[model samples]
Target: MSGHSWLLKLPLGKCKSTFNLEKAVCNHGFFMMAPNRWIPSSKILQRPLRLADNTTSVTVLISHPPDSSFLCVQVYHSQTPSPADQRAILKQVTRMLRLTMRDETIVTKFQSICPEAKDINFGRIFVRPLSLKMLSSASSFAIAGKRKRAKSEKLTTHEANNAAPMGNFPNFEELVNIDESCFLEKFKPILGYRAEYILELVEAVKTGRVSFQDLENSTEEQLCYEQVYQNLAKIKGFGHFTCANVLMCMGHYEIVPADTETLRHIRQVHGMKNCNKKTMEEEVRKLYDKYAPFQCLAYWMELLDRYEYKVGKLSELSSSRYHLISSVLFQEDTSNK
Candidate 1:
């Protein structure tokens, strides 16, 4: 990609577009997911957006009209960007700001299908693992083959390798294990199995063994959901929970993925104990069956409620103490009033 400049217009107003800025960005799950190492501003979300081709990532700014009739985007680069650069940026932009060119039907359909319609932004769709556009002076920009130094202390080789850039991941021996160890050592307290699950998907996408783009663009004639599900299921570490999460984030919510967290949630929210997988699946389906294909979204929001998190802006959680974040959520506050 070369370095160049252009103003991409989101044609919403000419078509009566009402893109609520806050509702739009908060739905991406990026804000709630500080653990992923991507950070964003409250009003204007800026992060490093990796090109689909994975050659390099560029930092971009996202803002809109006062009425937010259209989304205005300007991609910044160190050099002139190639045609591929613009296309890649546009694809990412489309995925991140799903309301850029949408019609009223999109919101209508989303609200009707989502179980907890009042809690989520019906008009927005989020990309799995999410996309970020880096800002100047961000420490992550140096996380490639060369690692970034912490202001307090010099990082070891293991830390350096584990934080290696996506492109440099393949160079590491057993890329999967490197990701696993990073989670175990650095992020294990909060992430638990989720680190391995997301890392599995990330490594697969980064290395070209699993292509998010290919699956996204495949026509039903080219590849059906069953075939896609089977292919994802074959990945060494992705079981039902991980596969459903990846697929649901990709916009397929036919089935809601349930795990121990869900069982605990049922105990808290619905007083169900000893819920078996079969029974659990049946219960979730019946509960959100009216929403039909969007049961997963319903299930996800309800689980979020159990964690005492509403669908809204995110706050930073200290890495060392993150394991205790959830504990604070459901714990009763019986301090003297």
Candidate 2:
């Protein structure tokens, strides 16, 4: 665990006034998932980042010193990371924090449209996709395959006896080059039919059946969101919810990834009593149409507020309490009865 430590500074640019590290990192549930840890005491976000070598993972601590204008990324490693490795680490951190000018503009515009979100600075947080391959697999697993206790128990067992810790979840290159048997064996705990979907996505990428170049470059002119959505729909196990979630990660926010929870939110918050599975999409579209391109952000802002109302401030939530999040939500639902 011994390693050299050094800091790399990234300027906040126009985002300095709007950015709050705690608010940005804790704004999303993915922060509670594997590999990402937000230390409340130190006000540092720590995670193990895979270097360019792909084999070497260095622990990185990201913090913004009080009254500082730049983010400090402290790399803990056996040696200073090469320039490429440093770039890789910074890229991941930037993606995780949505530190781009475009992202800041999105938040600014979103808040103007939805005054309720003006104070909270919603839509500024995002989870790292790592790569399209990982996004496909992880988003599928999260939205479709992950059940509360059942999946958690299975993943715990897998982590204990079979696969690497969740922190080292396979990267895009690893997934592409991984032996099919090894991939199946490593992910069997949560794979189920998701294995087929993940592999199908990998093969699609391998064969150039689907292009992620535009997404990687963040080039909206070259990206057709609907085409991507249609292509993803062709993959087994990718329904509307999963595809919308993937598109949202890729920066298309016109659609909300509605689920049972969304239905509840609409019924209770929006006063839409007849909103069920069949009408969920239409109802949500009508309700959040005012937000237009940032519909998902507005919807998510309300949802996150609801979660905080039930549990507590997400920024102050302890890592140890992450597991109880689902139960707490369930309890809120039942208690209303």
User: What TM-score would each prediction reach against the true structure?
Assistant: 0.63, 0.82
Note the clash tally of each candidate. 16, 0
Clashing pairs in 2: none
Q: Which ten residues in a row have the lowest lDDT in candidate 2?
A: 139-148
Taking all chains together, the TM-score of candidate 2 against the true structure is: 0.82
**How many angstroms is residue 228 displaced in model 1 relative to the true structure, after the best TM-score fit?**
2.5
What C-alpha root-mean-square deviation, in Å, does candidate 1 show against the real structure?
Answer: 8.4
Candidate 2 regions with alpha-carbon error over 4 angstroms: 1-3, 53-55, 129-166, 176-191, 214-224, 335-337
Superposition error at 186 for model 2 (Å): 5.5
Global lDDT of model 1: 0.50
| Residues 21-94 of candidate 1: C-alpha lDDT, one tens digit per residue | 55555443454443233323435544445444443555555566576556665555544546775666666666
How high is the lDDT of residue 297 in model 2? 89
